[model samples]
Structure formats: structure tokens, C-alpha cells
Target: MHSRRHPIRNAILVIVGFVALAGEVGAADLVAPSVQKTLEASFSAKGQATLARLAQDKTQGLCTHYATSPIPAKVVTEITAMGFATIKYPADGEYLGDWQRGEQIAQSGLGKQSSDDVEKPAGGNCYACHELTKAEIAHGNLGPSLYHYGKLHGDNDVVKKYTWGKIYNAEAFTACSSMPRFGHKGILTAAQMKDLMSLLFDPRSPVNQ
Candidate 1:
């Protein structure tokens, strides 16, 4: 009799193979003359998408370098320092805004593509990686569930500042983080960051409930 095949094990093996391939063909390999020529021939920048976007920043470069392995502690520290230096707190000392608008922003998944309207404001699309409220059942598990973020993290000044920095640039807290640097990359405005703070910290917001 033939032994039974484990589907999950097979799937994991396939994933491992792909990851190995990616490790061999690291992101830097894409910069090769032949690869660059092929990419240039295949894809073209349009609208908000520019050729400059193809170039990797220091943080992204490090992440790509260590894509297959864990980033060294020293490198992580360097990345964290680089990210921390980029944070700019609100000038008005106000860190909260309309929670309603925040909710809207969190739910929306628009902007930042070549096709997106340059005039319209961008959205955080927070729900894509977090479960913010009980009503919205649709959410992803790539990141931790933030259902009771304010309740768990508290609403103190220290917590407020930390949260703001994390939102502005997640790499500051955890180097090579998959989370976007919202404020650092100009993906969201100061007012929008304040609004997200309100959504996470305001007692009346559904996120806290």
C-alpha cells in the first residue's frame, strides 16, 4: 500500500522551494544590466508612478538583502535609528481628530497607484492588516488584531507619542517591518494621522468598544 501524502506538508515544501529561489535571485539581482533592460522593456512608469520608485531606499535595501534570512541585530538597530530620525510630530500638540473620518479612512483602500487621482486624498486601509472594530468582520491576520488597541495600550501621553511614531514609521519600532511608513512616505497627512490616533485612542470610537 502507498503511504498517504500530507497536503499541508507538500504545500509548505513548495513555499520553501519558492523562498529558496527568491533567496538565490535576491532583489539586488533585479538591478543587473540584463534584468534592468528587460524590466525597462516590459514596464513603463505612468502618472504618479515614476522610474524613481524602482530605486530602493536604505530601509528597503536592507530588507531585500536579508529577505531570506533574519536581519542582524546591528542592522535592525541601524534601520530603527534611520526610521526614528524621520518622524515629525504634530506642531499643534494635538494628536486626536474626528474618529468618524478616521473610520472612513481606515475602511478605504484607495490612492498611491499610477491610476489613482492625484487630487483626491489617500487612505490608510488599516483593515487590510488589522481588525479594528467588531462590526467589520472582514480583516486580515498579517498583523496583530487591534480590536482593543486603546484599551490594551492605554491613552497616556507616552503611549500616544509611541503610537504616533509607530504610525508615522513602523520601522522605528520594529526594523524591516512590512507595515508602510505612512507619514514618512507622504502617504498620509498630519491631519490624517491625528484622525487615525482618534480612531485608536478616543473612548467613544468603536475600536475601543
Candidate 2:
């Protein structure tokens, strides 16, 4: 007769293995082949999600490795540099679209879920992690309140570029940030990004009002 192992025990083994491997490896990489294999074995492909999701990219691998301790300045610099290199500015030099469309994008949380329509454009889902307006009482506190964002930052080329860059690749500013790489990873299109820009920069937007 055989006994099935407990899930927590298996997790602990992975962590222990990670520590041992870290001592041998220069970077404290957590996604060992075994770890990835285990993760892949747990989930079957569903809808838009695939086994490829189990694989970690360089940034993700680095972030996971450094989760237990502070990242060195060298690694931080590398991460930010990689992020900045991935941004692609609009051809027309425009940084904003309609604020009304932006409002809708910010409010929607659809697009990336397993059941979401892949053909449809993804939403910014901004309110999930930020307070964008006083009227909307429901908002998460994970990220900073963005209400009055335009009033506080002021409108200018510098502000506009910074805002666009930040949205495109937040990790360029704050390494290992949980914010989605909306532009860097092509999660949001150029037009969608402009709309989100308007949501933050337009005076008439609820974020400013």
C-alpha cells in the first residue's frame, strides 16, 4: 500500500530545494526545472491559458529569486534597463485618447481571464488596484490613490511622457512591481494606452474632477 504526500509537504520540499540550489547558483532562481515541471503537472490547459504560463520569463525568474531578500543595485539596474528598452512610443506622438473611453477601460476587468474572449480588447482594470474617483467607493488599496492625478502632476510634455512610460513599463520605475506590463508585453494596444492616458491626464476625467 502507498500513501499520497501532503501538498504543503511537497511545497516545503520545493522551497528547501530552492535554497540549496540558490547556494550553488549565482542568482537565487526559484523556478528550477523540477519546480516548473511540478507546476505544469498541476493544471490542464483551459481557454486562453496554456502550459506556457508555467514558464517564467527572465524578469519573473529574477523577481521570484529575490523575493526573500533585497535585490542588488546591479540586478535592479538590469531589470529597469530591460523594461525601458521594450517601450514603443506612438508614431504620431500622441499620448492621449478619449477620456470617456478611458473611463470604460479603467472600470472593466475583463480580457485576461480563462473564460474571457481573446478577440476582445483587454481592459486596464485600473480601479481594482487604485482609487480613481471619489464617487467610486469600491477600490483596492494595493496601489496609490489616483484621484486628482492630473491636478497634482500638472499637464506638460514631461508629465505626459512620464505617465506614458510608467503605464507602459512600471518595472522601469519600480523593479519587481506587480503592475501589469501593459505596453511592454503587448497586453494593451497603443490606442488603448492613449485612452488610459486621457483618464489620468484629461481635466474633465473623474480622476481629475
Which run of 10 residues does model 1 get worst, by summed lDDT?
8-17
Per-residue accuracy of model 1 over 103-201 as CA lDDT, tens digit each: 999998888889999899999999999999999999887888888899999889999999999999999999989899999999999999999999999
Predicted candidate 2 versus true structure: per-residue lDDT over 161-204, tens digit per residue:
98898899998888999999999877789999999899898999
Query: Model 1 TM-score?
Result: 0.83
Q: Give candidate 1's error at residue 52 in angstroms.
A: 2.2
All candidates: TM-score: 0.83, 0.89
Q: lDDT values of the candidates?
A: 0.82, 0.82
lDDT of 1 at 201: 92
> What residue runs in model 1 are displaced by over 4 Å at the alpha carbon?
1-30
Colliding residue pairs in candidate 2: none
